[model samples]
Target chain A: MRNSKMASHLSHFTHKTSFFTSNPRRPSPPCMSVVLSTAPTQSYWASIDAQIDAYLNKSIPIRSPESVFEPMHHLTFAAPRTTAASLCVAACEPAIHLMHAAAYTHEHLPLTDRPRPRPGIQHKYNPNIELLTGDGIIPFGLELLARSLDPARSNPDKILRVIVEITRATGSQGMVDGQYQELGLDQLGSEYDVIEYVCKKKEGELHACGAACGAILGGGAEEEIESLRRFGLYAGMVQGIQGKNKAGFMEEKIEKFKELALKELESLQGKKTELISSLVEPSLAAVQIS
Target chain B: MRNSKMASHLSHFTHKTSFFTSNPRRPSPPCMSVVLSTAPTQSYWASIDAQIDAYLNKSIPIRSPESVFEPMHHLTFAAPRTTAASLCVAACEPAIHLMHAAAYTHEHLPLTDRPRPRPGIQHKYNPNIELLTGDGIIPFGLELLARSLDPARSNPDKILRVIVEITRATGSQGMVDGQYQELGLDQLGSEYDVIEYVCKKKEGELHACGAACGAILGGGAEEEIESLRRFGLYAGMVQGIQGKNKAGFMEEKIEKFKELALKELESLQGKKTELISSLVEPSLAAVQIS
Candidate 1:
């Protein structure tokens, strides 16, 4: 009975055209346009958002055990946009978004037995369900990317490379490692280097992964992929630093990273980077607002 | 300091030759000889174990953030053998083992804040670390498989198919779904059909995935892969049922699955069946021992 009800809700959620499709009950687009006034950039971002939503709707098949799928759909679709998914180019957005949603789910898991008072999906569901839902989501994301591989239409090797990139970014050496280090932050102390390293691994690498995947999927040159990867790394660092420290305290460090991010974009001279360039500033504003 | 210690331990663990290489400190091989007494079969199983061990040692590179890697290595290499990994034919063992290890880690997680007293990796680590470790392990497994895709040596298309197979088997409709449904077992009741569906989804699909991957890696024909897949599904269902019910209560059902498992292998009459066919009986003995 419960399964059937959840399945119906899941169908409805997946059928919704886009998260930003003027649903009065839903909150307006959260973080885009905070610093930019360009209409073209806004439309580009909206297009990417719609692409992600459409891909998710088609890919996440409604099946048995709605208990797990329901939470995965809810957590993924209902969450506000992170810089992670928006940074991607081409069809990589949905795959990257799924990966981000998985990471977000695990990152927010309660360290203790007591459930943390958090908003969004975790707040509504029990921790066990959330944990399993996360376990399920990662593979679903990988499946989406794997399914996109076509010998005639796209470079299978590039898709393989993207898989390796995404996995490495999220694996032990990347995001998970950063999260582990955070558990012992007290013992490690508050050195800038330590914080930076952790922040890069936890947050920067994922953003870096998204940007690199975007370039890879977009058929960018090797140099372009590497440049965008660095751009994402620095941009993610700004977000990470802001997240760790108060807005004013890390302004100098944040500015340094923001400049570094723009510097990396210099190599992609002819490419349209207004949307990408706009990704870094919003982090600062978002941190300030919170 | 703690990170350094863990890194040292991780190095020692990864450098070990083989899990079954007669470590006096370790228990002898547990269930390999339970039913089959053939010396050749024992040697075949040993070789597969060594291959998996070699793959792990070579592929799992030692890097920074030892906290997460340490637990991942520990959980993966130190766990007792499951029928899942042993059933694979060729180089897919390591990849499948990693996936199985990830599933095993999630399966044993304590639902409440209070830790469950279990053996192996979880017994040593806190639930939070264990949870994060599981999250890291899945991608590591996928990385191993993706890293194996050398277009010069193997079929990239087949590798992609295997990736889809694995992700699908372990995704929401597979093992995680089984776990989720088990959480509501009271409402689900003890109907044979319900139990069979859950068991097949949880255990059977993974086993099916392993067998199919092995066949795919070996460049077996499509029909051969499908046949081996069915064989694995039936064998895994026997194990699943035995796991849920007492030894005596499900013997009849277990026998039915055992026969079904053997029947699926009928199409591959020319192929060697000794090692594959031997996988089914041990589950019965294993369940009885517990």
Candidate 2:
């Protein structure tokens, strides 16, 4: 469905009603589609949710030690999948990194006082993807995954690639850096040019990283990876400004980033480009300035 | 130098006399050897310090808006080199990941209240190793490094490998996870087996990652990489227990790890093995009961 149409439907909810409901009272059926509207984009979201659930079920088994796995299960299965993860899956990247993305995001949250208990049993199977949400139990969750990764079965090269892209995306260079810059801008106040630069790093960088990670994992060539990265960066730029509701040449800047994203997508080959374009439509559709 | 000899020198110092002096008051010469004792191991440390300083000077330039680079500059230059970085360097790994190690370590500190100002000018030569020290100036540093990496000049595959290893080392599976487990052990009160497991992760994982990264970078075979990683792991376990001054079974555990490390070293070919052994000696030497 068109962004405006979705927005209109969404606007009807009270301020307290989140865009995605977390209410336990709402009965959850076997399929999430029942809760979602018939709109194509909404269906896509449901499918992505299912995909995430399927991946988690297959990959992360319920382990012993309620302290570690419980919090992780809550974070991974219980919580809604991020748009970044959805976009990554939509682009056909391995969903494992999405787990990393979730953990990284959780790490930044202000919550502390995590569950504490020494680990029980030597977990034999270690997964390549480790979850380290520092609040407490989440940290041990990393250990379980590390143990789960069977080196003989896993591809070192692929694991390394995912690690590289995700770290670069989340670490000082990407999301966290952008956050730092945004905070800086808020405090000292800044000119338009400086604001734009900081916003790109603060916001645009993670989106770029996510898109680029998908392309990389999907085994896209250098040009394709670069193209997707640019697309995400530009898309993020437009989204950041729009979300902040900045005035003065905001429209012009958004248009510029939109065009940039379009240009990058046009440079790619085959169904992948089309798939990415469709995935990004909601973000682009957000530009109507209603 | 023998660990006992080194310990004797350290014992001579008053609490006011810091082991690794950060003070500028002491007389300085061109070489760091001036600050260190005449012992052979001390020279190795001096060399590592010089290497760190050199790498920082080459990678992190004196930029304008002194906010970001200054903090980063301080962190990189002032502190002694971590065995992880030194191991990575020894294994012929690219120095860029070292920049990341520094940033990640800095982020966890309690300091906050960073400078507020949008980034100035498109940093002409953005480095590939971006600096994201988010408390204030560090995040911008990630951007600078990201920009600095000229895509045409760098190898994407190698970069990705380094990223993966480093992130894993620091994240939930490696150091952070270990840290979380350590906290849990402290709270819950723990057993020797549990303590050993936790310490392996807490201390050993990052060291293992460092050694493995070096091996990978040095183009060691898969078996070789695994061996070095195992060596680092066992070695770190020994160091972790020793540092905590745990008695009884501690000596046995240290011997086991030391033996494991020695076995791995013996399995490797020629000078590379020698270099790694030399790099690890001081760490192992710290095991001396004196």
Candidate 3:
């Protein structure tokens, strides 16, 4: 009974076309890549928030035992702006696709991965991050995924596959592995190869994984899934490069990945491909400003 | 390629039964429950270690980017004694079951949950836990579940179902939710109701969830799974009663739960059930001493 209510609540958010109005008047900095497109779409951003609000409302059960859930709520719900999970969910508008995308994005976005904020500050605090504890965001994501879908209709095996994919993408073999590499690198002094390696593993891995999740859950063909996986990987690589000095280089790499992602989307050759293109186009745009 | 190799290595651990010899005549205090049975099983414990070693050896890729995987290696490979996941796997005594069992156990055993050993110590350090960060243990379980059984023959839907079950079991609604109830309670004066709630949520929830995982993964009937889940919950409730002064009550509760669990197992009257019974009996036995 609750499941149907939850689905209905989510359906309302997904179907509201008023949420898709793209804004053309927002200011753009000179370094913004072509992927950014023409003005920032306030509605697209609103859709992201709406999607997250609906996802959380329908997913996380707010009840007693405030201790366990409070941290998660604070970490996810109390955040000021957007989260990777929200971005992932918004990119894939509805239901199963939203969940897999959010889970993948949330799984890889570590609280401890951010740079220390201030000089000479022994304790670096990020309001956005609640704890450095292990995979804190994932349980929230998993809970959302589990609750968001109706068990009677959804395939459990596909759910497990999504879990496996997200876990692997965020696990020791994927994103965490990258964080491990970068942990004390400042003390060791960063080399170009090491920096690139860190960027690929830590930053790029989640984005790539999120993109692939959408592809897989959206019922893309095997070839399409593979292509999106590659697209996500390259796009993530570009997003991970954050230094202001690296803007030119980042733009160059972003364009390369953008072209690659577009080319991959072209392989599907159907309405499904068209829907996926819709997801990828904005994702590419977000990457320019990411 | 690596996937296939991983499957083979795991098979080697599960096939070796030399690890199950029980050692009787081990020292037991007067408070030790009858559920402890006649003897201590040293070999079974060894089997747990061996299984985890095989799992870690096969799953973690130790190559360049030593930074990423090393922390995971240390946390998983260096741990002493048997873990819940391993016990879960060992009880099943099979390769596929081994992975999911171990993974679920490892995910919820948070490092911060420990009570301070010294009265006045400001910082109590546990070497066993290394924060690879972000639901560190889940990936291992997901990997194990993913690698367990064959993709060719198994239903993807069923696999997904297992993932959903396990994730829910460990997520806020299951384990973390319990933890949330317990958090900061020490600061507040411990009320009896609060204590019981905390105990149920923090300690019992995972055990109950673990039992359910094994049941679901082992192919137990819906009734059997419900029975085991109830059995686990009751057993966990009993186990959560920590003070030695409450030992007698705890024993009675444990016995009641064990009987209930056994009755649930009895409901399955077929050859397939025999396999599940093997897994549950020892699990019930372990709960007495848990």
Top lDDT: which candidate number? Answer: 1
Error of 3 at A30 (Å): 37
Chain B TM-score for candidate 1: 0.76
Instruction: State which docking tier applies to candidate 2.
Output: incorrect
Question: Chain A: TM-score in each candidate?
Answer: 0.76, 0.58, 0.63
TM-score of each: 0.80, 0.58, 0.66
Per-residue lDDT of model 2, residues A1-290, tens digit only: 12233222222221221112345354221111121233355554566567556545543445544444444545555343445554454212223334343534333332112222123422121111122332222222222222222222333344344444544555444554455455452344555665676668655775676666556544556786788789888877776676664645577887788788888888764322333454445653222211
Q: What lDDT does each candidate get?
A: 0.67, 0.46, 0.45
Q: Which pairs of residues collide in model 1?
A: A113-B113
After TM-score superposition, what is the CA distance of residue A243 in candidate 3 from its true location, in Å? 6.6
Candidate 2 wrong stretches, greater than 4 Å: A1-39, A56-69, A76-108, A111-168, A185-199, A212-228, A245-290, B1-42, B62-66, B76-80, B90-108, B111-169, B185-195, B216-227, B245-256, B263-290
Report the C-alpha displacement of residue A46, candidate 3, in angstroms: 3.3
> What DockQ would candidate 1 receive versus the native complex?
0.42
**Residue A99 of candidate 3: its Cα lDDT?**
28
Judging by TM-score against the true structure, name the best candidate.
1
Candidate 3 local lDDT, B13-104, one digit each (tens)? 33332111223343211110111222234444454556556656656556545644444544444333322243244222222232222332
Model 3, range A141-207, lDDT digits (tens) per residue?
5534444453433545444555566667766667666655565432335454556776677556766
Model 1 docking grade? acceptable
